[model samples]
Target: MTTSLTIAVKRIHDAAAASDGARFLVDRLWPRGVSREKAALAAWLKPLSPSDALRKRYHGETADSDEAWDAFRLDYFEELDAGGEEAKAALFTLDAAAKVGPVTLLYAAKSAERNNALALREWLERRTR
Candidate 1:
C-alpha cells in the first residue's frame, strides 16, 4: 500500500468532468437535486460521517455561524478520533484505494473547507504520515 495517499474533495453536484479517481460519497444523506446517474458513485460511506446528533446540531441554521462552525469542527474532530471501527474501516478503504490512484471524497456540503470530507481527508493525511 502507498505510504501517502492523494485525496481530493468534490461536490457531488459538480460537473461530471471534475470526477476523478475512486469516487466515494462520505455523506450520511444523499444530495438533493442530483441524480444517481449524475453522482456516478463507487460507494456511499455513511459510516464515515458525523453522528446524527452532531450533524443536526451543527448543520442548517447553526452551520452558518462562525462560532458554531468552529465548535462543529472541534466536536467533529473529537468524533473522528473516537470514531472507532467504522471510521477505521473507511480510512483503511481509502488508503487501499489510493494505492491504485487518487481518491476523491464526494460530499454535498456547500463549504468545501468546512465539510466532513475535508475533515476526513485531513485526518487520513495525518494518520498516513
Candidate 2:
C-alpha cells in the first residue's frame, strides 16, 4: 500500500488555516514581520532551503527569465541531493510528519508561484513517487 502525502505550500504572511496541518518554515531567513507565534511552525528547516547564493541569483539578478527558473530548479535539486546531514534530518522530520498527516511548507517570498517552498514541495513529491 502507498500513502499519498499531502504537501501544501503557502506564504508565511498568509493567515494559517487548519488545513495547513504541520506547518514548516522552509526558508533560510526569518520573514521580516512575522513573529514566532504568528508563524506557528512545527519546525524551521533552514537546511532544506536554497543556498543564499542561488537565492540571490534568482531573486536579485534573473527573476523574470524562464531560463533562470529552470536553472534554479536544477541547481536547487542538486543542492538537495547533495545536502549535508542537517538537511537529511530535516527531510526526515518532514517525512515523519507527512506519514502522520498533511504538511504545509511556508516561505517569505513575494512571488506566489516561484519560491523555495514550492520547489521543496515538488522535490518532496518527486521523492515519494
Which portions of model 1 miss their true places by more than 4 Å?
1-3
Rate residue 34 of model 1 by lDDT: 91
lDDT score, candidate 1 = 0.80
Q: Which 10 consecutive residues of model 1 have the lowest summed lDDT?
A: 15-24
How many Å off is the CA of 33 in candidate 2?
0.6
lDDT for each residue of candidate 2 in 1-129, tens digit (9 for 90 to 100): 024888899999999999999999999999999999999999999999999999888887677687888789899999999989999999889888888888999999898888888888888778877
Question: What local lDDT does model 2 show for residue 119?
Answer: 87
lDDT of 2 at 78: 96
Best by lDDT: 2
Per-residue error for 70 in candidate 1, Å, reads 2.4
Local accuracy of candidate 1 as per-residue lDDT tens digits, 1-129:
355667889988896554388889999998999998888876788888878898888875567678987787778778888878877787777767788888888899899768888877776677666
